[model samples]
Target: MPLLPGAEPYRHEGNEVGVLLCHGFTGSPQSMRPWGQYLAAQGLTVSVPLLPGHGTRWEDMQLTGWQDWYAEVDRKLTALTDRCERVFVCGLSMGGALALRLAAKHGEAVSGIAVVNPANKMHGIAVNALPVARHLIRTTKGVAGDIVKPGVKEVGYDRVPLHAADSLRRFLRLLDGELPQVTQPLLLMHSTVDHVVPPTDSARILGRVSSTDVREVLLEQSYHVATLDHDADRIFEESFAFFARLAPSVGKEGTATGG
Candidate 1:
């Protein structure tokens, strides 16, 4: 399938310290490209994979589910583990939940984690209705492009595929039980005024995760798509610092150096 412009996956090979970034549900890699490029510029190997059923038309997304999305990120994490001495995982929105799942499932293999405006559960009647609604509805209004910065657009489907969204809800339910398994350092940043996800979701995650080293930052100026908002540079720089502090022999510039 021909991907939308700016929605293609991205990869950079720079050092043994790797960062794997996952984009949100109904979102393309374009949402994460700048963050990945920033990390890559700092001499970190970075991978931002377009999640399955994303980066294309909404109809294509209805054919896939959360398992497909999780599998792709898991595969990329394995690839990073194979090549990098230390690997960190980060994501935005639903991608943040994927990063948490990786840390839970892989344990010590993940050096750290960082996420922006992650969603742990769907809000309101939507969550309770998706199980049945998928059979009746095809799509709904999209939850993308929630940036506060003017003229900045998130490249994503204009509609949310019902089936895929239901699968995401199920994935989060399963992940909730696994939160205690996330023991690596975690840096979670959320937009204080996010319209897509409630702030309580991040609070729930912070309370449940077992990581002793965790930091939560509130993005005062951005919205749900903080990765592409006013606080974007803050997210990129802070996440890099979080990863570097946890990894051994990280240089002053945030790249890994031989001990």
Candidate 2:
């Protein structure tokens, strides 16, 4: 039988004040496992959902679109909000795009956002040149990079779906237009030497976001996947601190709240 809804091994639950972690494109919950583990240890409920067409086959990815991915995260975020007092979102790469969209559209419900190497634009001149290149670049081989774990080294889909890439481009365009709508505290962690998404993407985000409390941390030693790189610990430490500051304060009148 096919896996039931929310039956993936990645989902987990805990106390109130949930933290949702979204992994990058073609990546599974494994990419965010370390961060999720650390947060769960902190007594916060955590949910790391595998995006549609991922953690399975590359062809499956071609069959799916950005909407499918966003819908899945949306469901998890809604569930987290229903069960917790406040919700904070953290995402890596393409997942970061989804997280930003959530914050932009649901700013009233989100307490904070933590993004690692968010990809607001595709890298390389070819990506910019051929509007049809999105369909042409069908596969991206995983490299043995510093950011990937040994077992998870072969990251991303072997065959990148062109239609999906086009959909991603549309989403990025939408995010670019909606970024100023995000006014919550944001922590953007990006690697200076990232080989995938350009650092300029994060720089653009730092400049465009309307959030008054936006901070950027430069990971000098890592690559695109900062969440699993050598600087991953630092990402966790700083993110934990960011969320702590955003935690709702309890009033003397027996009410809990956050700004």
Candidate 3:
């Protein structure tokens, strides 16, 4: 299939087990590319699809709705499943929310899920007031930490569209209701000092999901963007191990080589 507009599709051909990586809100595939590279090096097929309105100007993000974001990732997930024997999903921040939605709806198809700083809820009074004061508040983007790779920047839209924030709230509500349905193995990673998302968000997901094999990795050095922060290596290693354990094996020893 041809690549979608503003979407970058990375394909590594080797093992059948695949991992679909999703980046955070207002972030691009660059944020997740490091982890993708690590997993690919381990012989797993990895796909990091750029979310709609990302990897471009922030102004372009204003025109897109959450449905557009979800649709794009859904298409990528479908494509990965078609090519791999087993597929797992991992996401950061809002991307984590998207991953949860996918695992909830497609639990039978997904092998496992790994989430980093999943934004299950909006924290603090100012952010909580966004729904009512979103019109008055014109912008959502600001200079975040300088933890990105060289030449990569993370700037969001100048204004937080009231409609888009409203859509996100609705999606969270839907996800809250659907959490009990997710029974696949789930691995959640979050930082203790994440400024954008609260640790409670991870706790909520841990409490709600029906998955019996849920595990949480608390990152001490990173903030919200754990994928690019100090604990990034740990995230890659743990996620690789998680997926590898679930991958189908070919030998009598049951050791799968990739992903």
| Displacement of the residue 218 alpha carbon in candidate 1, Å | 1.0
lDDT of 3 by residue, 1-259 (tens): 3332434645566477778988877677767888988888877778888877665665566567779988988998998899888889989888999999899988788999999988886555565676677667545654244343344344333345555665676678788889998899999999998777889999999999999997889999877777887899999999987886777441224233553
- Best lDDT goes to which candidate? 1
Model 2 segments more than 4 A misplaced: 1-9, 128-155, 248-259
- What stretches of model 1 exceed 4 Å from their correct place? 252-259
- How well does candidate 1 match the true structure in TM-score terms? 0.96
Count of residue pairs whose backbone atoms collide, per candidate? 0, 0, 0
**Candidate 1 colliding pairs:** none
Best model per TM-score: 1
- What is the lDDT for 10 in model 1? 96
Give TM per candidate. 0.96, 0.87, 0.86
Arranged by TM-score with the best first, the candidates are: 1, 2, 3
Please provide, for model 2 over 1-259, each residue's C-alpha lDDT reduced to its tens digit, 9 standing for 90 to 100. Answer: 2432322535556666788999887677777888988877666778998888876666777788889999999999999999888899989988898999999999789999999999897665555533566555765554223364354353445556666676777788888999999999999999988777888999899888999998889998778777777888999899988887888431123222222
Per-residue lDDT tens digits for candidate 1, residues 93-143, read 999999999999998899899999888888876779999999999899999
